[model samples]
Target: MIIVIDALNRHRFKGLLDEMHRLRARVFCDRLGWDVMVRNGREVDEFDALDPAHVVCLDADGDVVGCMRLLQTTGPHMLADVFHGLLDGEPPLRSSRIWEATRFCVDTKKLNGGKTRNSISYVTSEVMIAAFEYAREAGVLDAVAVIDPVMNRVMCRSANAPYDYLGTPKPMGKVTAMAALMDCSEERIQAIRDFADIRHDVFLTEDEAEALFRSNREAPAQRTAPPAPFPESKTEKADQMPKLPRAPHSNALQQYCYEQVLNAKSQSDVDAAQALIEALSDALGTTSAAELARLARVEAQATRKSVLVAAK
Candidate 1:
């Protein structure tokens, strides 16, 4: 199996889009039964602008076996509109800290690498490697997916994915799943690429996938198998995550600024807010009690919202 991780050009993009629609029609509209919109055997949506989109391919003997779509979470992305209903509300997308991962599919017909490949392992490894490259190029700090609970475990175990539960796995026509975010990191991404090594056919045969599954199963017990690295602490993640800075604030705008501070993404924002609060408190040391209470109210409201969102 060969992995192609390129942004689809005009002709290539159209061809790929056609191929995607064909595959979707076969699996979704015809076999399992879904009501996806299609015209002349193609799936086209407003989102397919050829920008903020990526396509990954698994070519075996010139035949496409697997494919996935990636989208960035800029303004008007799925996370804020269509997919937002899948989760509690919109995740922190405005800070440009995370991207959305979606439209993942594998050709079951070509899975297990046909008869030539040793086992199902080859196909699985190819998929993993392609996914990591997609994540890196797309600047995806996190990936959100609505997938089967069983497959969710496979993602966590085989791909070293870190996730948080969003909702109960519900049936979407034939697919039963819930949404979750896979935390992206350099270490986990590298491990996937190393295991995939598509330059050689080593990871694409059936025997390899079986071995991978077996080894993964016994990985916790096997001293030689490296465990997934521990994730950074919440505070550390918050520090790394970017924050949307405040615009100029007037007396009326000061309340809004205080609210935004509570929703801060990094420690710097929190520290700044703390400093401002201290300065204001000191200045109010000789002021009337009424004025001090008004200032406290602004800070308190902002802090409450920020903490609540972070906890979720």
Candidate 2:
């Protein structure tokens, strides 16, 4: 499964982000030897502080198996600031619709199978799809990536070839970097999906992902006694009961949907937004909060009554 984490929601996925950073440390610093900074076994840099959206893919065990970072071109991104050498003395291409993708990696040790669904190849396609689709939905037009030669070839072989290149390859120590541009188009997404034969949706709703993470939290391999400082008390048995997860997206999504429906200026707009909320109700299979639903009905009825009085 794939989850897009950015500044708005990164706090909710700290553990997942930690695992992703550690995976980056292993891939970029240890294996590929990219001369990245690894502090406390996590490969993070100044770019990470910029609140880029991290497209992270998780294995079946909920461990981060793949990840890539997306940063807007208007800001201080790697290509413009750190990788200007690849721009060939040209001003860094900066546009609101363009985003820079960097630090793409997958856990090869765990996803060792060849081109199968659970393999590295398939996961790579999924990550690319997530990044492009997510960015496109957010109004991104093209993505520039500072990638090694190996990734460039992999993209070509996997039907994700870049449509253009910015400059000649520049050797950055052991790794030679080249800037490649890929469009965030439906055709591009579909072609990658075709190459990987992946038909299912790659994204998980926040609630669904939270439930999965709750279930996937690892348990102790062997039963162990409580630590000496924290001795078990008589009521500890009750406290140890597995906690139930709160319903996902019911409160927040329902309120937002109802707001969209009720606050619409025209009846047609109201109907359209109401239809969306109904569809969400079916998809999530969760009812809105009782009080909020009651309040929405009351307000809706009042709006209709006012409209009738005005017409009469």
Candidate 3:
């Protein structure tokens, strides 16, 4: 499903946004060799801070598979500021009715296999349809997309080809970038839908989106480390711990447990930390906190072993 994330509701979907940024970093910086700033595995720029709308496609596992950014052309956009060379001597187009679309990418690695068109093409068309529908709903008349020749070809194949071009294509890094203008009309949106064979509404409800974002936040920590081996001494009695109500200060408890795990020095210390985390997880009835604690413990254990090896 596709989710429209903007500044007004960004706080509620921070996890999803983080994932989108990471995906952008992987696609643009790592794969495409784009000259974009990536910090801590997230691709973010001044445009992101300008409250642009992000149309993101989520897979069945609630992971972000594709995304496209939309910004008002009247303000500072990529074509007007960063890619002005492509415009030659012509002035950058600026209009409230026309929005700028950029940073369009998909996780091709995750969507590698399919029978007909492959997952990349499928999600790419879906994102385009969602972007056009979102722009039309927001009263936008047209969209100016700063894309490469490859993406231009993809747009043509999807039956959502641009109606006009701003200027000549100019080489930027390994790819040539050009500005293509597209109408924000139902006909364009429907064309992409039909081409992609997607007829259903590609949006998630607010509650469902929130749940997916929360899962995205907790899942990384859980997957970072294998489950800690339960110490034999505490194995039998661990299940006897009383099930308490969810703690109001669960965040604080999680932080404390994480710190404890990080400070662990030996196997016994790590075992105790794991046992404490399990106890807290049972009490709060949430695995997120325990997962974080386990991640910290695993990191500390690895560091300790490395130090021992160095000392030997």
lDDT of 3 at 215: 47
TM-score of 3: 0.69
Residue runs of model 1 more than 4 Å from their true location after superposition: 1-8, 89-92, 113-121, 167-171, 193-312
Which lDDT tens digits does candidate 2 get at residues 1-312? 789999988888988889899999999988988878999999999999998999998754456899999999998999899989998999999998999999999999989778886799999999999999999999999999998888999999999999999978999899898999999999999999999987878887665455344434632221142311211232443244222233333333333444453455555555555444443442324444333334345545656766898999
Q: What is the lDDT of residue 165 in candidate 2?
A: 94
Task: Please list the C-alpha lDDT of all candidates, in the order they appear.
Answer: 0.49, 0.76, 0.75
Who is ahead in TM-score, 1 or 2? 2
Question: What residue runs in model 2 are displaced by over 4 Å at the alpha carbon?
Answer: 222-312
| Per-residue lDDT of candidate 1, residues 147-212 (tens digit) | 676667666655555558564555655667576776667677666555544343222222222222
Over the stretch 47-111, how does candidate 3's per-residue lDDT look in tens digits? 89999999988764467899999999998998999999888789998999999999889898989
Q: In candidate 3, which residue ranges exceed 4 Å CA deviation?
A: 113-118, 216-312
Error of 2 at 263 (Å): 36
Which candidate leads the pack in TM-score? 2
Q: What is the full ranking by lDDT, best candidate first?
A: 2, 3, 1
Please give the lDDT score for candidate 2. Answer: 0.76
Candidate 2 local Cα displacement, residue 285, angstroms: 22
Looking at candidate 1, what is the lDDT of residue 193?
A: 51
